[model samples]
Target: MNTTTTEAVPLWRRAAAELLGAGLLVTVVVGSGIAASRLSPGDVGLQLLENSIATALGLTVLILIFQPVSGAHLNPVVTLADRALGARHGGGEIAVYAGAQIVGGIGGALLANLMFAVPAALSVTDRAAPGQVLGEVVATAGLILTIFALARTGRAALVAPAVGAYIGAAYWFTSSTSFANPAVTIGRIFTDTFAGIAPTSALWFLAAQVVGAVVGVGLVFLLFPNRKAQP
Candidate 1:
């Protein structure tokens, strides 16, 4: 979610937490997707429902567990948003966080593949359709708005649940199934399972996410111009 209040935590420890959290978060996503495909067979809708529910609940728990140490900014977009919103993180720290997240995400996907007995192969699932790109923009934008809106309003306590819920709903509402986080998106590329995305398609999604982040930050400034000073 937000990392603005974790300045006291050493940068290395924070980065480790981010890595673990991001890794586990992707494990939940990719693992659930694989499980759902097996559990639901031909029913794509049912598979998505199972996947979304698992991801939402798992993410909430991960955030709760890691937030104290690292603020649990598992997504690069979230980390960047924290910096853009003046969260006291320097460029170096931001790079560390993002690097850890990406590395962890790839590890998570590999773990999920190994656990599911799936070969570690690049995904062939192409998701570069125009509608999917649009879906990513909306999904990423909503995700940023949701996280910062609560953080700036001093409702940081709600970030875990709210983010979980938003992503779960976005899975159904958005055509791209709400791969809102760039780290997670990249991770999915390592698995050829149900949740995986082709590398070529990932480029479009990553770009859309960046654009969405900018739009989201603009919206935050528009709606919550004055960030409440933390005690």
Candidate 2:
């Protein structure tokens, strides 16, 4: 009998990957939003198109870059789901990953704001409307579903592009422009740009994301209960 076991990567390295990857992800998101807003000042649709393209491309590149080291789980819910789905890492790792992501997101927002020559400011744009909240739940659920379903079906290689593409589409389809990430949500509050979300509305967005995560997990189990863990 022959068996192969994967060596555990050092915790510090994984944490670093999480932090850097998450930060860069936010940078792409917020930076593109700012650029789009300015570059197409009067045309909302054109701004959205530009932002979505940049985000999709950036996310794909980021995931491809970091997936080997950290599994490229940039989102907290993705980390949680990996643990729940029997990833070798533990709860402690999850906490660290989430913390790193949150910190990175904030740092990324600040960096983007600085790059744009905009003062680092808190968002005043309120997005707590009912339609936006509902859109968040749907967007997050679809995102989670996209990730795990691919994992379950042995299509891990496709995750980067698929997830990126899904998000790009969700930006257009969802009322809230698919702010499906908690860390990203928190980070966006620091920017007063097009990508920013008001601090007052952050809690509701967070709640909706959590609800979406739960729904996504439930769907995964229902659809792939017997699936084996993938690399």
Candidate 3:
């Protein structure tokens, strides 16, 4: 258990580790979300709540599993932002991690879609209404900011429970009740089912999520005031 944060681990190995970690997380998030969506056919609120709860549990497990290997940064914005903020993970490694996460996420979504037999319409169309965009932004920003703070505080292990718990609660607290990762967002499109976002509107959500991630980084700087690099 050489968990020293400064030394660079093997790029290929880290990439592979993160890919599997993120892929498993996305699978459970989308798959269990499908089950929740089917449970509450008409009640959008209930359905969203179920999706969030399942996602939180899934994320918790992923963090516990992958924290040692790749920091479990399943989101591109998070990987890049952490690097920029003087974290130990390198830029080249971040790119590989992000790429792997995207691939794994897409694969997970496809599997979930086929497993649940989701409708094509749900996969191709934008599910995020314009009215919900603000929540999407604030919620995502809050998540990223929290992540930075946790990392700086040397509480990376808490990320899993925190994200999972927050996502589960976010469904009830926020208007959008959406998962904010771009890879996960796009991956959901393949499922074309309960957790799916339309391909057409995916870019806008992606942009919003990135914006939120930026805001989160800024917030972390203001709140945590990192004097030097963290791991």
Candidate 4:
């Protein structure tokens, strides 16, 4: 237990922290995205661009602000892999973090749906098609890997817009449209709102993301090997 993040918390407690933070993030993101979509009316591109920029800025701010408290992994997969093989190991923390992320995402989506007055879509079943899924894998892989590289190297100071920029760009370029955060993906399952996904396809996308995350970590090790941990 090097830090509070290392050994002070139980799994359920950590999950609670992660969930609370994640829920707040998703609320802001999905809420903003919907509001933009409404304001744009006909121009989805401009609207999405606006959405992306805002989201990036927001994400950066949130990560920087919360890093001290939670390390702001925000994404469960990041927390899990990082704890197991990378930085800031903590017992029972991974499960808690992952659980919280999923629940938080759901809370965010629900908020978005309420704000938007979304029609009876019942499900945001819009999973990435085959082509899109490939894009998601690449984008998510890049995102997780980049995040780990920075955090482990003590370059977390640069994280202001790291997840935000990655997420915004991934939204623009990827076919699966970058389900960059596993928690966000799960949270979105609750509603067919702006960022929602159908339950059936959620698992597949999640599976791909896990794979992408692994690949990303491996690449990081090869390209930017870690320094020996200090005494």
Q: Which candidate achieves the best TM-score against the true structure? A: 1
Task: For candidate 3, write residues 9-79 as lDDT tens digits.
Answer: 67787778777876776788788878887888888778777777777877877777777777777777778
lDDT of 4 by residue, 44-148 (tens): 787777777777777777776556566677887677667545556555556666777888888877877787786545565667578766776797678867776
Compared with the true structure, the alpha-carbon lDDT of candidate 3 equals 0.73
**Best-performing candidate as measured by lDDT:** 1
The lDDT per prediction is 0.93, 0.86, 0.73, 0.70
Tell me how far the alpha carbon of residue 117 in candidate 1 is from the true structure, in angstroms, after superposition. Answer: 0.8
lDDT of 2 by residue, 132-182 (tens): 999999999898889888887777888899999999999999999998999
Clashing residue pairs in candidate 2 are none
Candidate 1 lDDT: 0.93
Native-referenced Cα lDDT, model 4: 0.70
List TM-scores for all candidates, in order: 0.98, 0.95, 0.88, 0.86
lDDT per residue for candidate 1 within 1-231, as digits (tens), equals 764588889999999999999999999999999999999999999999999999999999999999999999999999999889888778899899999999999999999999999986999999999999999999999999999998998888899999999999999999999999999999999999899999999999999999999999999999988787654
Q: Mark the regions of model 2 whose C-alpha exceeds 4 Å error after superposition.
A: 1-7, 229-231
Which whole-number lDDT from 0 to 100 does residue 54 have in model 2?
Answer: 96
Model 2 local distance difference test score: 0.86
